[model samples]
Target: MSPVEPSTAKGAATRARLLDVAARVFAEKGYGAAKFSELISESGLTKGAFYFYFPSKAALARAVIDDQERRWVAEVQQRVLAQATPTQQLADVMPAMLELLAREPGAWSVVRLVRELGADAGLADDVVKPMDAWIALVAGIIRDGQQAREFRADLDADGLATVLVGAFDGIKGLVDSTSPEDREQRLTRYTGILGDMAFAELGILAHPRDL
Candidate 1:
């Protein structure tokens, strides 16, 4: 059976409340460690109300991951990429994601939840994978950069976009493994290293920190 969608203002508010509290809790405590009771208590929703909106922990986790990742992606394009030129936008992408992660608990929650709820989790179909939006954004950036002669015209934009996005996501995990004090600097350095090696042949490379 399909879960009922919120039809009234109060119902919508209740659902939003649950997602907000759930994202924070899941970010602070991994999905396995987060308690359902605490989610209900912190959200100020009764057990009955919680289940009305979300049928199970898996259901709620799916909603939270999808919702938060969509918001994160929109914010990246609207807020982070809005000011930069196409070449600059390409450089800013990974470092800006780390900067957002530092301030946004919701982004971290998506990261944890995405890892926890992979294809075997039974709800993967519902997720708006962050990588898809990022790859599209990078592809657009490459196209524009190529038009401006900022990126090489010899390469296919979408192909280069896929490679760079994969590289960025992988490097991000590496940055996360370092000590807290070293993480940000490492992110900038790693992104720079990626730019140096990857973009040097193809574009006018700028370290993300420099941009």
Candidate 2:
């Protein structure tokens, strides 16, 4: 038989399908328990076909991280951070990130996997590097705000970035414990207080709504 023709759309569809299934599998079984066979079966693809796209289970895990990060940066980060003021950008994006993680718990499984893998030097570098980059991005925005006088000149950008991102990490647990409506209300209150504190540290006067 002659070589099969490849359609770009079909290839894209396959990749999307695989990623979707992989998210579910990773969430259900976790990184250590997740299996390549299950992913292949869920994708309705042969082992060789799956390998052609992802190469290995470790590679697939990396793809999952990258896929989530890209969607997060595009949909959540861009929507908020693209605004005029860095403070406004962070304020808008912070709550949305909380809501997104709360709504899609499966999406946070990669975070759990990364944390679990942190003990391994090789895996830590792979996983932790992206996290550091995200933190660095946030720090950069804070620094910009300070330079513009949108934030206090004395503000500690790196420290503030760490606290801000660290605050959001605990949101998943809180969200899991409450009803969606209650979660929203509680998160609003929580974020409001956090915003107040953050602005206060920089000696900046901010309305609660600004956060």
Candidate 3:
């Protein structure tokens, strides 16, 4: 069953608190390892109160995933794209996402939880939908760039978008495994390289400053 939506302000606060606590708990300890008691304790909510909002741990996990996707699309994807040219928007994608993940514990937790669940849990598709949206957004930008002669007309925007998304995801995985201090530097270098590769493929002359 779906989670209960609280109508009152206090109820809404309580629900949000539960989600925040659950996200941290699940992220720290994988969904299977995370206990209901830990979530309740961290949330500072009683068991009865917790059950009022979330029927089960699985339900809470799903809620966290859904919320993460919404925030990512609204706050990250749409927000960044709104103020930049298509090429600049594409260039900003990875850096913006990496920054968001670094700053937002809940966002980072959602990514960790989704990775832990993998494809066997039947949650992969849901978790990956936001990424699919990102791909579409990037494709649109690439198409715009092509029309403006900022990118190569011979290249397929959709195909290049897929490759870029795959490259970012792969690099992110590697960066996530490194020390926190090194992650930013590693990501910056890796993404810069990817951007250079994209620019080269598109026959665009990238300024050294662009990297």
Candidate 4:
């Protein structure tokens, strides 16, 4: 987790500014290339101001991931939850996230950071595992559906959720090497195939949603 968030308004604004600059920098140059000197200069904050919120690059990186994850859980997941049935709610996960990615630059950085930092970083205790949180969320939704007789009773909700989340995240990586136009086509194809197969097998739907 990040150091305690600022309790003061001015401190909060400064921290947010740093995050905005850092997110872009990290996105352009992966974590290994990002430096505090560049981040502080880009944010127009003094060294002391930057250190006040983040003691190291690793800390700031964790904050970035946590911030983006919180937004997805709040903005994307909550919007999907508004759907009438658990089936609809589960089905909306991919499209809802795609919408966020379309507008949020920070989200793309989080994806790169998750793959990079998780590979090394060696700060397992400090870094928040957003993937784990996602799995728990999906599994909870699956359990609710199962209990309501809306999802298959024979399937293990946790395992099923793990597979869905794993495939969903991995499928996004498949687009990184494609041309911008082809990226959307491939994502839609992969996501639709995954969602359709999973939804049908779970008895959620026989046909795809508008996604």
Q: What TM-score do all the candidates reach, one by one?
A: 0.83, 0.76, 0.83, 0.89
User: How accurate locally, in lDDT, is each candidate?
Assistant: 0.74, 0.70, 0.75, 0.79
Which candidate gets the maximum TM-score versus the true structure?
Answer: 4
List clashing residue pairs in candidate 4.
none
Give the residue spans of candidate 3 off by over 4 A. Answer: 178-181, 207-211
Better of 1 and 2 by lDDT: 1
**TM-score between candidate 1 and the true structure:** 0.83
Worst 10 residues of 3 by lDDT: 202-211
Better of 3 and 4 by TM-score: 4
Question: What global local distance difference test value does model 2 have?
Answer: 0.70
Q: Which is the winner by TM-score between candidate 1 and candidate 2?
A: 1
- lDDT per residue, candidate 3, 1-211, as tens digits? 6789999999998887788778777766667788877887788777888889997877788788777767776676776577456677777777677777777776656656666655545766666665777688778888988888788888888888999987887776666655667666788788888878887787778642263
What tens-digit string does per-residue lDDT give for candidate 2 at 52-142? 7887777777777667766775677667677778778766766666667667756756655665565567667776555665577678878
Q: How do the residues 31-139 of candidate 1 rate in per-residue lDDT, one tens digit apiece? A: 7888878887887777887788987777788888767767777877876567657767777677667778778766567766766676454656555365688788878
Clashes by residue pair, model 1: none
C-alpha-based local distance difference test score of model 3: 0.75
Model 4: CA > 4 A from native: 1-4, 124-128, 177-181
Q: Report per-prediction Cα RMSD to one decimal.
A: 2.7, 5.1, 2.6, 2.3
